[model samples]
Target: MSQTPIRRLAAREPEFLSTLDALLAFEAEADGRIDAAVTEILQAVRTTGDAAVVEYTRRFDGLDVQSMVALELPRSELLLALDSLRPEQREALTIAADRVRVYHERQKGESWEFTEADGTRLGQKVTPLDRVGLYVPGGRASYPSSVLMNAIPAKVAGVGELIMVVPTPRGEKNPLVLAAAAITGVDRVFTIGGAQAVAALAYGTQTIPQVDKIVGPGNAYVAEAKRRVFGTVGIDMVAGPSEVLIISDGSGHADWVAMDLFAQAEHDELAQSILLCTDAGFIDAVHDAIDRLLPTMPRRDTIARSLANRGALIHVDSLEQACALANRIAPEHLELALEDAEDWIAHIRHAGAIFVGHWAVEALGDYCAGPNHVLPTMRSARFSSPLGTYDFQKRTSIVHISQAGAQHLGKVASILAHGEGLQAHARSAEMRLKV
Candidate 1:
């Protein structure tokens, strides 16, 4: 038989952990040239503002435009795009948007306060950001789903303004993308992309308002620009490639398992997809299914390369071991295609999203599952969480100490302040004390 593209590993092997580590390693070192370019573009935007933005947009997007006005798309354009969509396409988008909105609504935080015995009120005030920027990848790639996922949460959180930036390479506009903007209630639309678009959003140009935070995905240049401008403006995250790890117990069809892996693989050559199975025969079956099904994929070459590079079919002794190993990997998307999937969720310590049971495919979570598909990648699930309404809001501590409360707290604060050797702090607290 011909060799399968993915590598096989036995968990019982002495070198298993080391092999797994090697497979997961990804380091896209920053190129000096790209860094220099991003830095130059950011500075130009910072200093020159609108003029720099126009020049960069002209050079990069191949758009024959002179001023910011040419680059800005009015609300009417977005509405026209939405109205132009075919019935089926429009229906699908509306359904998906509705689902996403409903899900994020549950994540919205509320302000709360409580009174202490001394009448001091301690609380938190949750407020949405005043403005947010959404950067949708344009030109060669455009994802209308990106708009729904990023915008819905911010809108649900009540962000005052939402600005969208998408590049129209060679003056070609994506109607679907504009349609998404129209439906999502984006306040403004700018047809600019790459580092220049990020810069304009980070530091407001003549027309583009400075957003409090920026969210969405883009190319390497966009990623670098977001990283550079993080402190100046909040950013969602510099995400890594897509990933999915499926654990099976031989109950599900091998072909279904194989297709799930391909879904992640087709995302890019660096995307990772792995299958952990207790039955050796099932692992081999999945491998065969992969070999059989790969050729039919439109992105077959990309999938093959991804599988060859990072994909794996791991043979585990038991479901327990598989669960433990999954925790160690901290995958972005995890599928528990085992019996009583919900019962096993407790064993899972980390994953950006979990798909339960054989019917719960990871692809569903990507599109209409209602959860934000913008998840943390590269083992960051161990520390980070999926993007949600919480990410769009900020909390401020609310403390109101009454005279009675101050009298009781002043002594404590004065003592701690003196111990820290700050006389000013001690005096400040003492002055609040009663004579």
Candidate 2:
């Protein structure tokens, strides 16, 4: 038989923790050229507006367009694209968009207020972002799901306008993405991408309006542009590679577990898939399944490379040990493939999304499971959360001081201000105490 496609680790080994940490390390040093180019592009877009955006579109995307008007897709074009989809594709897009909209509708928060005994009133005003820009990687890479995921939530949150910018390299547009925009209520569509697209959205051009936030994924250049323009506009998290960690308890079929691992591995060479099981015999069965099935996969080469580089089939002492290690990894997708999967969910503290039971696969969550597939990666699940309606909304604290309320709160503010050596603040609060 050929060599196994994955690495192996034991919970009892002396160097297990260190070895695992080594495998988890994914920090690639920033490229100086890419950063420099992004800086220049941002500056150019900021200074020259529509002219720079048009020039970059022609140079990078190879689209021969004289004006920005040619780049913008009117509402009628979007409608025509939607009409052009096959019946099956249209039905599927409609269902996915509806499910996403229904899910995010539950996440919409309401403005709330409270009154104290002293007649003081205070509250919070929950307001949706005025406008948002979505960036989708175009040209042969069609991600209609991204349009559904990002745009549905923004629409559900009552965002005023949603602009979509997709790069159609050499004038090749993905009709599915445009159809998705049609279904998700995108107000505008621009055939522009990369750092320049981000720059145009962050700082408005003549035709492209500035947005309150930017969402969706793109290549390295686009990621860097979003990173630099963060202070000027809000952005979804800069995500890393997709990931999945499956913990088995010898109950599920070995082939099922193997395919789940392969599902994540197939995303890209950098995507990670690891299986943690307690039974030694079950581990052997999974290994045999991997050997038998690896050859049949269309993306066999990518799967093999990813498994060799980062994937693992670990043997742990107990289910408890698996849970602890999973918490340490903080994976983007965590699958509990066991008989009592629900029982162990409480033990998991950190994960971008949890797939409970054997049937609730991660792939379902990617498409129709109704949760946002845009999750934090690179162990960032420990600190961040999935994108949702809350991401497109902002909260402002409301404070209205009454005469009796000021009399009570002013002294406390005065005391704190004086202690901090800010006499102006102290006097400002002190002046209200006369009431």
Candidate 3:
């Protein structure tokens, strides 16, 4: 794993612009593949129901699931299995869940009504989703943190029910996942995954009931499936490859920066880990650190491909320029490793989540930290926000008017409706006034 550190002049040079184009091209091609796969999975699940899910699980996940009916794990068995976990692991899960719950509890909204001087009352009513589906990636990587992150928010929002789905590639569910589900009080657990699980969640099968919304992360196929089922049911976002952008000065530690970059890069070959720095010497030191650390890491092959293909070390004239480049990328994770990171935060307009200071690593946010780990990618930070209690809840505006208040406000509404050529609307308001 070799590193390339280049010192180039300021300005949006053609070569630098080409680098951006290359990254965009990579993302587009990846998205296209996901779209195709998701369309097929959605169609199959929509038509065949349980049979389709079972078939896809066998084909894609390499597990011969007997039937979709077998997808739902019995709640009793799930709880027993969780109880079998080590005390330390159970304690850690409980701590993480408590922290996540506490943070999200602070985010809860109330339904309140306010009365106006004219006897008109207006307010907003908050309601939790009837049911929500959470997808946790299975196989070799079992994410207990993901369970706490997704479930705690929905639970805090007072969701009526929560159903969790996870792929059991080896025809056996991970004890850790079940334990996490139990710890977080997940309502139901399913032993299925891939695009088929997404389809089942979107369009209910004989076994898995349709949910009001689907949340959590998955691979390309899962992401595509979410994209396909979006209209039929609500989805959080069409997540893309993981990415992290670090803005560091000469003061940042090279080893920590290298390890942080590798943390994201190891997620997938398409994942990007970039560094924007004002000091060229620090860039070289980090490059050396990456080379030293890559050989010892278990996922070196994945990390290497991600770095060689998509990763970059951008040299900028000043910290302001580095921030400008970061905003343009709109990376999923942004780290400000400068001396005074707090002062530079105002300049950051785009980023799924911003980590300030050297001690605030992105890994903390991924696990025990309060904020959600499920964030928008592919420059989606420009418009979207991280998943939170708000995602699993809905709000409806309330309005009530007394006879006198209606009489006073109706004339203005009638005039506006008539001006817009909506005669029915004008008549309705006029009739209400008369009443």
C-alpha RMSD of each candidate structure in angstroms: 1.0, 1.2, 2.6
In the predicted model 3, the residue pairs found to clash are none
Q: For model 1, what is the error of residue 383's alpha carbon versus the real structure, in angstroms, after optimal superposition?
A: 1.0
lDDT string, candidate 1, 195-218, tens digits: 999999999987888999999999
The number of the candidate with the highest TM-score is 1
The residue ranges of model 2 lying beyond 4 angstroms of the native Cα positions read none
Residue pairs with backbone atoms closer than 3 Å in model 1 (clashes): none
Model 1 Cα displacement at 399 (Å)? 0.5
Q: How far is candidate 2 from the true structure (C-alpha RMSD, Å)?
A: 1.2
Quote the lDDT for 242 in model 1: 95
Order the candidates by TM-score, highest first — what do you get?
A: 1, 2, 3
TM-score of each: 0.98, 0.98, 0.92
